[model samples]
Target: MALLERITGPRDLRDLTNDQLVTLAQEIRASLIANVSRTGGHLGPNLGAVELTIALHRVFDSPRDPLIFDTGHQSYVHKMLTGRQHRFDTLRKPGGLSGYPSRAESEHDWVESSHASSALSWAEGMAKGFALKGEPRTVVAIVGDGSLTGGMTWEALNNIAVEPDLRLVIVVNDNGRSYNPTIGGLATRLHGLGQQLSAIRTDRRYERALARIKRWVNRTPVVGEPAYDLMHGFKAGVKDVLAPQGMYSDLGIKYLGPIDGHDLKSLELAFEQAKQFDGGPVIVHAITQKGRGFAAAEQHEEDRFHAVGPIDQVTGEPLTTSSARTWTQAFGDELARIGATDDRVVAITAAMLHPTGLTRFAKHFPERTFDVGIAEQHAVASAAGLARAGLHPVVAIYATFLNRAFDQLLMDVALHGEGVTFVLDRAGITGPDGASHHGMWDLALLGLVPGLRLAVPRDEQRLQEALQACVRIDDGPSAIRFSKDPLPAALRPVRHEDGLDVLVEHGDPRVLVVGWGQFATMAVEVGNRLAQQGIGVRVVDPVWALPTPKALIAQAGAHDLVLTIEDGGLAGGLGSRLAQECRLAGVRADVREFGIPQRFIDHGTRAGILDDLCLTAQQLARLATETVLAGDPEPAPDQADQRG
Candidate 1:
């Protein structure tokens, strides 16, 4: 039998021989490649975390002693060891195991982590709870080097410094890259070698004394200058003897090492020592490669197979390529074109330059692009600063991530009326990633922001037009939202009535259908079916989803039956807002709405979820037809060859 099958839980790892453990590690790696090849996931992060996870399980008993992951992408190995091997093949599939740590999955899993850089704060709270309850247990927080760039990590550390006697272990997996090799000062400090490396926590008086001694020694002779230079240059070894502590030590947290994370024995020993630490919260600094096992991931350093679609297990080649251009590709190509002409245009992303379609923009203007780590709040606030300085900063980020900077958007950008354009990709139900990942809340939340004009483009051309229009805005903030779905053919407006594009017009229409953003195409199918049923209908795709257009309100008032559809939250969404606005305007229309319900939608395929939610074209068309039939129908006036 395979060694991994025998070991189902953390206790089973205790009896295994060192040789057997090594064999198990190999099996686990093979299993990872096998399972992830068919169902794509966070392969690189999980591969890098094998030894460290095994060591963690060996040292600390979970369920009793909670181990929390910052960005839980690296918890795949943890899942394997904790009796989840049977369900291993179902990873990321609907009704199967989730990609991140799920509380519903097992008792070993504590936090359902997806967003970055929040483990330390969670650990601190858990630590405090253990202390209050008189429970003698260690709280371990595993954070990545990339996550350290977030302000929350430092915020937790500062607070943890106050209670230095707490039993807390923060394991910083210093693998160097976030999605694409990390940037900023923290990454440099983590990789710095020699004596200056320990200077992160060096005392001021000691530095002065060392400087004085160096000057005096150098003044003596040629030997002294050479000796000083040699000692400073050999910082890797000599500095450890002189300056042993680092940034964590200065913050009152005990420091561990620049230990090799892949070395199972070394990691086990380091974690064991951290377990016995009584001084304060300690940080175990383990250096590791992002993609330790797979050759393809190791060779491709950036992201290192960070996320993938279905691919060959051995060769690591993708199985297929999408033929249709997505909204992201359209945005990236257009943004690059915009950057070529406008020198004031700068790009900012919160550790998502590539995913948010800023890669082309960065390639075109490297100096103008700034990746401010995984700090979303900082990205918005910094954009406000750039705008105040008379420069246009285009902040491209996921719609889900924008939730992190709502306060900043309202206070810093909107209050001051900064001319910042936010380009939100994945602006609707991002399937397979689960509830927290879906960008379903942006439309609802952005409605609360005064002077904020949000444009939900219907197709590729509209996305380009919306982005250009947002750039032209001189006051407040303007944002354009687009989904990760494939870009359909450009829908040409048959006619425009007060900026509302008439996509499909029927002769003397009584029922009017308003489609918002990507839902515009779906509404066309509904209109086509309605025309066949001998129901005269007019379908219009609104350019600006928010701040209801005057013509839209007037059209709704004229029609007895009006239906609005949006690929967003039902509450305060385009449909809900439009219905509310029309009602207040004294429109005698029976307004019907279709959208995502006000609940945490679970993980599933986008098509499956839409079908289940009754958002599909066939289901919506039938519902709209029935609703229109219930209302009083308008007389067929001048049917201009309605039947093609």
Candidate 2:
């Protein structure tokens, strides 16, 4: 039987010989390439994690042991071994498997740790629970060194340092990259340690002996305290001659590697030593290549094929290509142009230079750009300082990542009133990456923050214009959000209104249809179709969906029935704000809303998600027609005076 086909669980891996395990690693890599080629995923991460995951499964029992993975992008190999191999074809499909680790997926998958640096804290809590239950179960945390850059990792490390009884085992996957070649001191430290490991040969026996010797020397004699201290000093002196242990040991955690991550046997032995030691938390730092096996992924410079779209498996070329730009590309190109004229225009990102559309800007103004590793809070707070220094800083990031820096935006940026522009890519319904990846909360959350100017641009022209406009504002913090989908060129707007752009219109427009951002195109199409059905509709861009759209309220008062369409969360979103404005404007018309509900949406195609949310033009038209027919709105006294 084939190695992969025979293994259904971790227990099955325990009996495999070293040669057989190595073969299984190859099979896993082949499978990863084959599957990820069809449905794009974290190719480089999964490839790098093959042996580490195999070693982890062979060493510890999951679910019982509670294996937690930080930044679940590297969990594909874990999923394959835990009995989901047959469903590889349905990788990121709607009803099939999720891209990230899901609690509902399997018993082996415990925590839904999609965010970075979260596994350490989660493992801490799980260890406490196990101790309380009087259960002797192990807790393992496999965190990337990139995640160590985040403040939460340090917070968890501080707590884990004092609580010796937590009995947590930590595996620091020192891949030296997270989305991009990692930045800041943590990356430099990890990279330096990785080089030191390379200088020494990959040897488990020698490393194990050193660990045993260190533990023995650190052990107290119970009665002879003076003797033990003297012996410890002598051993420390000997180790100073022999050496390895930097920033990690200084923080009170036992430092183990600079081990070769690809060496399955070596990694297994290291993990075994860690499991046996109950002294305190141990960090098994295994140096790994991000895109280990795949040639195309390994050769790439930027992120080493960190994430990709469906591509040709052999050539590593994208299957589909567009002539126009993605929202990311558009933003990056425009920002580069902005940086040309303004010396103060600077760019910042949280180790996501390429993904956040800052790559071009960084190239154009290398000195003006800053990549702050995987720390979002630092990214925002630092931008506030940059803003105060008489510079226009544009902090570009994914909208969901913005959640991590919300407190900073409120306190540091907004409270102090800094003129920082936040460029949010993937603002709504970012499909395939699942719940945590979708940036559905930005539009609503930005509403609650005080003294923030926000803009949602529908097309490339407006997106560029909006970015420049936000940068020009010196009042406080500002943001401009755009979709990942390519903006349609065919559906250009007819004209512009007061803070609104009329995309399309027909007849008297009894039912005024307002759309925010990219949804304005759909709203125009809805209006065109509704015109065929003898119902008039007018489409407008509510340009920025913040500070209450007064223009929409004014326009709503004149129409018999008003409808609003948005691509974000329903609660406190554009639609809800429009309703509030209409009521306050004394417009007695029935204002219908269309948007995603205030719940975590699942992975699917963009069209599938929109259709489900009733955000599609056809669905929007149907829903609007039904509501208009059900309670044909009656114009109130204020509507009569407003129209006149």
Candidate 3:
């Protein structure tokens, strides 16, 4: 049997010899490449984490010890070792394994959050809890170097350093990239000659030998005390010269390593020593190469295949190609074009320059592009500062990640009345990446921000137009949100009514379908289908979706039944806002809201999730036809209560 197939749990790894462990690491890499290539996932991160993960399992008693992975994308190797290897083939699929670490999947996964930089906090908390309970469990936090760039990691470290009783081990898996290369002061501090010094000084054997020498010196005469003090001062001086890890040591936390992450024996030795240490919290820094064993991933410079879709495993080329432009590409091209004309235009990203489509703008205006390194709050506040300096800063980030910087957006940007344009990509129900990855909360969240204008564009033209409009608003902050879905062909409106674009109108329409963003196309389909069923239907797309446009409210007044469709949370989304506006305007049309429900929606294809929610054209048409024919609009079924 193959070594991978023979292993059912982490304990099986303990039986393997050094040569067998090397073979196991090789098998894991092959398994990762072969499986992730077919299913599509965080291949590079997992590839680099293979031996490190194996070593962790060998040293620590997981589930009891609690291994908390920062961001969880790099936990694939951990999952495989802990009996989920059988489900590797079903990764990110409907009713299958989740892309990130899932609590539902295994007890081995304690933290399921895919958001970066919070693992150290989780480890600290777990360590505290275990200490309070008098449980002799060491909490292990396996964090990436990219995650260390976030401010939260330091905050947790600051607290963890003082707690001398807590048994905690923080493993810094320094692959040197998050979504892009890790930036800012922390990454620089973790760089260079620290590796050589850590290997010599931080080794467990070296520590033991030093302790023996100190014991012998203390047993001697009065010179023994002075000699030991001199030795300590010399050691600190050497550390300052040779190790960049003085940053951690200065914070009063025990620092070890810059160990070779791929070397199983070395990783195990460091982890084992860290687990045995009684001193507060220890940081074992391991230097790893992203996409370690895979030549294809290692050589492909940009992010080292950080996250990939289905690809040719051997060539590292994408397997499927789409001729249709994505909303991201359209936005990137438009932003770059705008930057070419406007010297004042600048860009900012929370370490997601490529994914957010800011790469094109970055390439041309490299000086103006600021990658804030997994810190969204910093990005937003920094954009506000840029705007204050007379530069129009366009902050491009994923919609889901914007939740992290809400305070900055509301206070620093909106309150200051700064001309900061936030471009939210992946603004709707993103598939495969699961609940945490879905960008459903931004519409609801942004609506709550005072003086912040939000635009949800339906197509490429509207996206470009929205971007142009947002940048011109100098008095307050503005945002444009678009989905991860491919850009639909531009929907030409029959007539522009105020700010509304009427895409479909049947004679003397009784039912009006108000759509926002990508849902506009779905609304048009539903409208046409309803018209065929002998119901008069009008479909309108409000390019600027938030603030409940006056024209949309007036249009809603004329219809017998109005259906507002969005791709965000139903409670506080655009649909709810428009309905509230209609009530305040005394528009008596029965308004029904259709969007994501208050509960968390599970992972599936975007189309499949929509169908399950009865948000599809066929389902909506049937419901709308019934509501109009009956002449009394009842409440729409709660998506949370409905069967998938």
Best by TM-score: 3
Better of 1 and 2 by lDDT: 1
Relative to the true structure, candidate 2 reaches a TM of 0.89
Residue 187, candidate 1: alpha-carbon lDDT: 37
Summed backbone clashes in each candidate are 3, 0, 0
Candidate 3 Cα errors over 4 Å, as ranges:
178-234, 631-644
TM-score of each: 0.89, 0.89, 0.93
Residue 303, model 3: lDDT of 79
Model 1, stretches more than 4 Å misplaced? 178-245, 630-644
Query: How big is the RMSD of model 2?
Result: 5.7
Q: Residue 319 of candidate 1: its Cα lDDT?
A: 83
Of the candidates numbered 2 and 3, which has the greater TM-score value? 3
User: Per-residue lDDT tens digits of candidate 3, residues 1-644?
Assistant: 88999888889999999999999999999999999999999999889998899999999998888999997899999999999998999999899999888999899989996999999898889889888888899889999947977989888988987887789889888786742343323434544455445545545577689899999988789899889989988988877665556778777777766677788877887787677776568888877888988999999888788899999889889999989899999999999999999889999998888899988999999999999898998999999999999999999999999999999999999999999999998887888898888899998889888888888899888888998888789988899988898888889998998999999998789899988988999999999999898888899998887777899999988988888888888878887788788889988767777888777778888888877777887877777787777754453465432211
Sort the candidates on lDDT, descending order: 3, 1, 2
Total residue pair clashes for candidate 3: 0
Candidate 1's TM-score reads 0.89
